[model samples]
Target: MALRRRALGLALGLVWGFAVMFSTLWLLFQGSSGEIISQLKYFYLGYTFGYEGAVIGFLWGFVDGFIFGVAVAWLYNYLSMKIYR
Candidate 1:
């Protein structure tokens, strides 16, 4: 079965974006700075452990997840076509 690239991308983008946003909020509410969360700033520029940072992280995560999902789906389809032919 072939995977729909855009559908997979969108699904992954939403999941990843929400994951980052919620994780940030969770840490913020807990009143502790997360080491892992803080590390995201290095990869996602402008990201910090603050309210505004949650939005930034979400955007970065969405783009990153979307590209990764699309790439994976494309590779899967390409390999399946080659093998089934």
Candidate 2:
């Protein structure tokens, strides 16, 4: 059951990270998406997409999202254990 819980946490964390990356970019770069597109460099992972943010805002947001996701997951796990126990 712990594995399931951890998996759920991880999935949620990833989604949150992507969301944060996109939304933050939009909010922060509203009206400048095109201006930042030229700065992006598409990246790929093993048979998977890595980073493909064309806009600077999105790229920045994407990175922030990754960080936020990890932090959020950690916080979630910690809080779950602390409060539930």
Evaluate all candidate structures by whole-model CA lDDT and list the values in order: 0.94, 0.47
Best by lDDT: 1
Candidate 1, residue 59: lDDT:
98
- Tens digits of per-residue lDDT, candidate 2, 56-75, equal 33444445555665666677
Q: What would the per-residue lDDT of candidate 1 be over residues 1-85, giving only the tens digit for each residue? A: 9999999999999899999999999999999868878999899999999999999999999999899899999999999999998
Candidate 1 clashes between residue pairs 3 or more apart in a chain or in different chains: none
TM-score for candidate 1, residues paired by index? 0.95
Any residue pairs clashing in model 2, and if so which? none
- The stretch of ten residues in a row with the least summed lDDT in candidate 1 is 32-41
TM-score of each: 0.95, 0.38
Report how far off residue 49 is in candidate 1 (Å): 0.6
